[model samples]
Target chain A: MIDLLEHYAVAIMAILLGVVLAMFLVLIFFAILNRLWHNRGISRKREASESIQPLIYSYLDGSINRSDFAARLKNKHDITATWESIEIMIDNLSGEERKKLQMLLDLPPIKKHFLRKLNSRKPISLAQACVYFSKKTLTDKSIAVRLSVLQEHSYNVIAYAATLALVNTTNQGFRDMALLRFLLRKNNASMAVSDIIFKYYDISDDKEVAAEKLEFFVMNPDIPDKTRAAVIRMFPELGFYQTADTLRDLLQINVKNDPTGELTAALLGVLIDFSDQKLREIVEKHRLWESPSREVRLKVPGVYADIYGEETTRILLGLAHDPELEVRMAAQRQLLKHRPLISESRFEPDISTEWRAMKKSGDADVSNG
Target chain B: MSQKVLIIDDDPAVSNFIKYRLSKKSYQVKHVDNGIEGLDAIRDFEPDLVILDMMMPGVDGREVAEQVREHGLIDPNRIIVLSGKKMTDEIKALFDIGIHDYIQKPFSIDLLLLRIERALASLKSR
Candidate 1:
């Protein structure tokens, strides 16, 4: 029995060793193949770029006509390279040159090439095709339908790219459907979601219509608090000041009821940009400085300062004593800026010492000037 | 003699396109990729106008502009900045340092050409 067990153990060890050896060899083989593939790709891209650039420039300068340029760009191996070159030109050039390039993208061969890529099973190829389409204003309903399907792709990147492409379409129904799907996606990274929403606004021909669509998302209670907050935050930057009144009302409501504090904080942040006497009254009525949410209270100093200007000295001084470190720091930093208006004698001893120390450290001077 | 224009931009696509356009327009153009090389080109090439890209890897356009202004390598008014950055206080400060003009990127090439012509014409007048 002992001899039989020993033989079995030795056989198992040999098999395990063979498996490990096979894996190592496979790894080595793949590494070499990957390096060769990468080098070849780089060389091919370089050659394509060198050959295609002059043709593009010539086309731009009117030396080559559109048909001739499209014909030259038809090299199957260099299609990606040609598209990339055209993409760069489309991004950088405007006026007649840009129009010509945009028209070139619709030429039969180029459109067919991208259309074929759109049907690719590979995620990277599909995503690239989607991105290429996003840069163009699509009139093709069939392409939009393909993009609509891809927007639901399990891969988040391909889905996001497809959604962006759909948003670029002139079809309002397609654009709305794509955006609604994108906003409803639970797995989206916050920054990517923000960017896509911004892109939706960017590509919209009618700013007012876009604002109304954004307002719907902002006002919809079923939409995630994060998305609403992002939309609210973008309003000031996008110059949707007309939404300010609605935002103020939302802030009042959220101040009373928002559980997460994120939405309330975002409202406060945007309102600071559009702050006025009415916003100031709202701030005072809520006494937002003493809000239960620390995030909301943190925004109080900026809103107070903007609405009250030099008169914010007292509130800044009061907030300088807040329980939260960040809130106190924010208030103190603002206080330092208003140092000229502050009466040092009114400061309590501990606060006085801290203020003097902050001054001596050059923080005050930096803020004051 | 044709006017000399030096382009300091990292993007070959942009620099090459500009070079081709300017060369066709009869301007002697030289292209360099980064700020350090750009500074050297400023001295070596002594271009009548410098088309500088604001953002680059090492030694950015602002520093190059500052050095040129400090050393009087070229007239501060001869520098035109190409930036994708929106107009901010920082960009406004570039004008205070005497940059000739700021053209936002994704800019019309024709608009850029027009600006270049006007800048050079104004220089000739001065």
Candidate 2:
């Protein structure tokens, strides 16, 4: 028993010593491998920095554009340090060198940083930065940044930021109108646009600074067509009389291409507000009251009422007999307001029970054509 | 109970208009500027009805509605969606999430109050 115990003790000591030695060797192996990896990584980074130095120097010297810088540095991998260096380089650039740096910094990351900062800060600097970048003809990036801001921020912030940013760019007045349109595209956002109009234009009274700005935007062809179309749509609300000829031209041109009922309706609304004599003349010439587009038909009566006053019932009497059910329904609504006093001649031949008679007519027209 | 109603919209004008009208009818009203505060106020104020605006920064009104339903915070029936823009898909989306009524902006205050009264009265009858 004593001999067996002695052998067991020796075996235990050997196992403990073996484990300690193995652990020490393993630790040393890991430490060496880690050191080697660290050295290799450092050397690779240094080599990369040396390789990127020319691009950086060129960028700082104002030879390359911002998009190219973003593309070149995209794969440079050391984002944090790289951006810091780029920012520092941007700060040192002189004259046109500064412009080039500004252009190069127009990448998404830089813009995203601006967006983040704008959310928490006053945004005046970001707006100025955007304008500075925009003047260098950075349309693609500038537009993308502006759109993102529009989609993601409060309308007030977007309006304030975009308005300031547009001040230095070409056709800046037009850009503001486009931004407003984008901001206020949906049914819910009309009120906000109206608020902006009220704040800027006093729309109800027909004398607002915002109205003059919109007029300037309309006259600027340097603005894109889409933005122009949107501004034209808002013209009636602002009651810009100078655009009457422009509005008539647009309405005539627009009627040829499916008569965008909503826009026509809006234009009609404006002309009604202005009580322009030309409005009735154009409607009579185009036969817009009986036009295929429900949008135009719905709009005609309001203008007719506004132009001839509510007592002049001739156009409304004619409109009441129109074939398009929606138009007839709209006429009916107008007639209903005058109520009990409506002439028997204006009574429809067929008062169909279908609730969506106008909707059905629209569908039929679409299918037949 | 005061029949308290809360409005959560980013548009100050909208929230103010609703607050002013609802208070005139003697309904206790509270307003919050965005969805995050809106959610927090729901817990603290515990309004009888909530008028939610659909679009906002960070967390939108739809997500706020979803959170309310998932957590059983506000009664699903008492929520009214207020928007200036109308998209059928959005309406269907809100409907699927359990919003009971919707009102478009630039509304007549009289019409809105009537709808609220009807919705609340209908709920009581149920």
Top model by TM-score, which number?
A: 1
In model 2, what is the error at residue B69, expressed in angstroms? 22
Model 2: residue B81 alpha-carbon error in angstroms = 14
The candidate maximizing lDDT is: 1
Q: Residue A289's C-alpha lDDT in candidate 1? A: 82
Candidate 2 residues A34-100, lDDT tens each? 9999998788676655555556555543566555667765443443334434444432223444455
TM-score per model over all chains: 0.85, 0.37
Model 2 lDDT per residue over B23-93, tens place? 76799999999999999999999988888988888888888999899999987777999776656788888
Once superposed on the true structure, which residue ranges of model 2 sit more than 4 Å away at CA? A1-213, A216-227, A236-265, A275-278, A306-325, A345-369, B1-126
Candidate 1 lDDT, B44-117, residue by residue in tens: 99899999999899899888989998998999899999987676775888888899999987888889999999
* lDDT score, candidate 1, position A335: 71
> Which DockQ values do the candidates obtain, in the order shown?
0.63, 0.02
Which residues of candidate 1, in runs, are more than 4 Å off? Answer: A1-41, A187-194, A256-260, A291-295, A306-312, A322-329, A336-341, A355-364, A367-369, B70-72
Residue A188 displacement in candidate 2 (angstroms): 19
